[model samples]
Target: MSGFEVAGVVIGALPLVITALSAYKQGKEVLASLRKFRGLLDGLIHQLQTQKTAFYLDILEHLREAMVPEILQYGDPTEEKCVGILLDAKTGTQMHDYLGPLHEPFLEIFGYYEKYLKEITSQLDYIVRLKDAPKDDLPNIIRASKIQNASLVFKGRLKFTIDRKTLDALVKDLGTERYSLGKLIKRVKTKREWEANEPTSSSTTLTLAFARVRESATLLHKDSLEVPTITVTETCDQLIHATARVQVKSICDDAQHSRNQGRVLALELMSDALGLSEAKHKPHQSYNISTTLADFLRDTAQDEDARMSPLNQTLLALNVVSSVLQLRPTVWCNIPWNSMSIRFPIRLEDDLRIPVCAPYVELAADANLLQSHTCSPKFDHDSCQDDHARDGHSTVGDITSQVHGGLGNKEPTRRHGNIHGPDACCHLLVGVEHEQIIASPCQGD
Candidate 1:
């Protein structure tokens, strides 16, 4: 090789070597930072187990022993004064005259305390739900609990980031409010008044109140407000699961008792159809599924309401027929194969009969709305009339008849155009090619 050429190559290699060394150093620094961050997380998990856990337990203990019993004796948790607590309602404008300027502060304190008490109860309930936890549900519950905690952490972090005064102010407000409640409790006049103030709906009130308590706790804890890393999370979860198994039997028993009493573990809105008429002047219309319908669903072992519990997709369809009918109110003619209304119909009556005849038509789901599921759409090219003729599937004619409830072979004549009348009733009939809708206006006696 030429001497000049070898010299050029050596000179070029110097910058390359330097760059590589710099990249290596940068990578090492990143790894070291990650390790340090991990150590912080480990300490956090330990703190959650030792100090924070005990602190939360202590908070609950004070609330349970001190506040809860007092509120129970008072009846209305919102009541600001002893007289109001005894009365079980608002103290009227008379309160404004007496307490005057202090009334607003009293009311403010009452509201904040109520919210704080609620958070405590919610945190307690969440803990209670997990304490007698099963191995199978522990992982899922932990994940959910983490989500709840994140909300708290965000509030605490906000407080910490802003100023020291926010925390101090909150503490002062809480203390003053608690003292007010204590004084109000002592002002009860008669035994009869106390009895009258008893909580009419204790269970619902308790559940809602506890939810607020957990919310408050998350707002208060600043130092431990950061989200735990996977290592710390898993460690904390392990600790909880280890301690939780002790009361599993009792928790299971409590759960079972709650179930038998028709306890609602949760409630979910099945579809937007539930509140579809909100803008319509006829708000809270007669179209809702009532308690009578719920009774009927239980009485008849029909699997029409697929989302109804136990047989159960936790979310129940509010109304099956109206929902389907509402979606295609304009298309009143062609029964669209791809409409979601067929699957998620608002359930009304227990008389729902699922005809296996028609194939479920799936439309393309847009990503912006929800992630699209792979759909194997069974497309029936036939008109609505022909769609129902298949074996095992109820014919359109039969479905229409069944919907009529044997009122008469005399069906209401199909009417179209803006329906404005005294009493409006609409029935939709799906045929192979089109859905024939019969609308009739009624004259009430």
Candidate 2:
């Protein structure tokens, strides 16, 4: 071959060799990565499967114990039956007790209402056939039917007719079967007023209010708005509180049930990487019950970021409340009057910021950087007087003296960085972190 031809061949061969080497190196690296990834994935999958199995077993066992009677009672309506079973758990009993006197009576009232609705539909079955009748006439029929037993009194300007027998039946059911919620409400209010008027030495009114809050929380039949207003601060807050209580209780209950299942689900999940699943093997116990089905499914997935949803957040809140209440039952038994406001933490809407302060807590829409903190030194709104802060801190004394009319609050001024003393009313460590909203103190502070 000529010199030019030989040089061309050499250059072409060099490039082909280089390309082959590069391809070989890349192939080896890719294979190594795949092996590493496969091992990791296998470990993760095994871990998840172990956890998934344990969680189901633990919760299922608990459900089996808690739900037997409820299952039998509402067997035909599976959803209702499951709910009843959940309500029968020890956690459920704890919830009822926390609610105090409100629990049994509220459930009883709800039971009556359900029956009432059923009875209404049964009595009004005539309307389904009388679909051809004047629509206006149907309202009158329903109204007349409802009032025959004097069960309902319509104040609005509306006219309707009802067959006499249906009306009488409706009235009779109201008078005999249903408890008078109106009367119960009136009695509660009356008791409240009497307690308010009584001497401070008697804590009877506070006790009554505590019971009322519990009762309100358990009221299943009330409108959503009413439920929050009764016990929680804002509507959203009430929802959050309710939801949290439920979920946390489930997790705890599930943990407890895991013993019979050989290992707790949460711990089993951790063991997959740790290799606990291989250590113990037991007969697969069959469970007829399902507890926290939503959580069980989600936990087995590969996605690590997939967490308990908003519903789960609610459950967490409820569980936290339950845990706190179980630890401190007396917290709800009495009112802490020293604080400026009382707010129960509940989430009603997304992005709603629920405050831990009292109902009267307010922030003016237009104000400078104003911060409110729960203070120390027993800050009862009614008892505070001016000049209380000036007694010891002489540095700020000049400012006090220069003022023509003194500052409104007598509770000691909390300068920045002041360590809270034991006597501090709010027991709050006031800082930029604790402050929420730029609020102006009300006239009374």
Candidate 3:
């Protein structure tokens, strides 16, 4: 009896041991796979970082040489053949036609800027504010005072300058029409011409003076395109303090608003910086920020209206710089005590205002960091089951794309819907033509 009972126990224990061993092997495999995935991800992230850093360095490299000189040269009155073109009130269409060849030099100057910007895309970190600071302590329980951060404390709207003389000249020239009385009268019937010619000598005035003048000046043109600029301050201290609770939800929320404002500003800045409004392409769609920022530059910079004033040219260069610098999101890491902080060390500037669009795109983060953080998966909450496939119900994703054929003489554009977030971005393109700034409070969807 004792031997049989011992043998039965041994048989049962063998299966239990095998089951335990299988479980351990499975667990080890899972851990190994996770490590492999993380390693791969780290490599990819490093590659991305390297590529982006190189691009940023390239942009910075062009600073001393490419930016100011090009802008100054483009707007130089001496270089512009049409700058002092006389405001001829007669035959304006003819005058503009004559001045067309003169604007070529200015166009050639901005072409390089457009070309550079087109080469880089989606390599900015918007989360890090322009003015971020490193932490006092590190390698311990990481504190909130060590990460990248940004905030849009409203620096009121920027005032853009208008070229008044040019606008006025254009209006005056287009207003007047030259017509000879003899030719006009000749077009009239013989009877009317005879009646008009008869009152020459009998104490009646024979000649009538008719001078051509502009019918109206009010609608001729806008005085200036308002390129509104705002100051955005990114404190390293603030970013460090804010990154304590950095999560996907928060990043996503910020991204929604920031991108919206960014698009608007990009368009405004491009329009203003490029002198795009006055471009012969007249009220173009794609060149504005609403459609594509980089594409606009590449496409419209070649248009007839792509002639840029020096200020506008500066803005375009500035926009490219800002866009690239702003592409990277501020590095945020979660900390204890419900706090978040920035992970990277950064240099700070005093009350620095970098021009940018609002919420860039959300970033793909580390899984370990993600697992350790408090974030709710973006899934349907009402239908809850342990397995994603097991749940029969479908969750509709948030849709942002809609395609349509645009009006004639217009570029195809993307019309973004209203978004909800704590920080909303507002950009105005028509006024300045380049991406301009505005920081708004976050509102719920």
- Write candidate 2's Cα lDDT for 52-163 as tens digits: 3332333233334334444344424432233334434454553344334544553565455334333433322223212244322322333343344443332221111234
What's the TM-score of each model vs. the native?
A: 0.14, 0.16, 0.16
The number of clashing residue pairs in each candidate reads 26, 32, 53
Candidate 1 lDDT by residue in tens digits, 1-445: 2221221222222222223223433444556634434333233223223322332233233233333334345433321222122232222333334333444544553344334333322322212123345322322332334354443321111010112343334344443434343343234223325545765555455455556544433333332243232111111333322222222223334344545655522211222111112232311212232223333344435645443443222112322322222334231223442323243213344774332211222333223221121112211123222323433334323433322222222233321111211011111221111111111101111
| Every model: Cα RMSD to truth | 36.5, 40.6, 48.2
Which portions of model 2 show Cα errors greater than 4 Å?
1-103, 123-167, 175-179, 194-445
Q: Deviation in angstroms for 388 in model 2?
A: 56
C-alpha lDDT of residue 147 in model 3: 39
On residues 1-445, what C-alpha lDDT tens digit does candidate 3 reach at each position?
A: 1221221222222222223223433444556634434333233233333333332332222222223233234333321112112122232333223324422332232232222212111121111112332211111101121233425211112111213343344233322332112222233335445656777542231111111111111112122223222112221222322222122233333445445545322222222122112223222122212223444445446866665555555555443433332323332322221101111111233643222322223223443432232222122221122122243322211110000111111232311112110111111111111111111211111
User: Which is superior by lDDT, 1 or 3?
Assistant: 1
TM-score of 2: 0.16
